[model samples]
Target: MAYSERLAERIRKALTHLPIKEKKMFGSLAFMVNGKMCLTAGPERMMCRIDPDLHEREVKRHGCNTVIMGGREYKGYIHIQEENLKSEKDFDHWVRLALEFNEKLTSS
Candidate 1:
């Protein structure tokens, strides 16, 4: 599935004045900071990177889940369903988390 251009625009707007690079990954458009992935807007969901310790708390919310693939889980990386990001406030929740975690997430 192709990433959502509209969602990308919203992310750009939300993160204005910051150095954000867009890249292709996981069949979506990922926004990166300092060479580390911060957020991804896919066709069906937004992949958000945050503090691993907060994963359990976040996944309890509606439309949120751990990042699981091939039976492996990537802590702190979550899939937030599209329905949860319909509002600007909802989107900001993730934007803020991504920004905070970007500082802690090591760049590769």
Candidate 2:
């Protein structure tokens, strides 16, 4: 699966100050921060790693869906539709959420 360069660029700009590494993962472009998976840009969407405690609430938001694999739902990981990221605020929200979780992983 090919990823989106536009979205990838946006993410690149967002994490400009962070020690971020880009890698091909899950058939997408993944942003690894602090040596942990932070976010991923798919063709027309993104996967974000957030706080598991907030999963129930966050997934209820527009264009947000819990990441599921092998019939198991990954609470902290979410798939965000591209339509919901048309605005800067929404884009930033997802990026920040992923970064916050990455920070926690780094601290522990």
List per-prediction Cα lDDT, in the order shown.
0.87, 0.91
lDDT of 2 by residue, 1-108 (tens): 699888999999999999889999778999989889999999899999999998998999999899888999898999999889989999999998898888888896
How far off is residue 89 in model 1, in Å? 1.6
lDDT of 1: 0.87
What TM-score fits each model?
0.91, 0.95
Q: Put down candidate 1 lDDT per residue, 1-108, tens digits, no spaces.
A: 798887778877887878889999878999988788898888878889999999999888899989998899999999998888998888889989988989877543
Model 1 lDDT, residue 52, Cα: 92
Per-model C-alpha RMSD = 2.0, 0.9
lDDT for model 2 comes to: 0.91
Clash pairs, model 2 backbone = none
- Judging by TM-score against the true structure, name the best candidate: 2
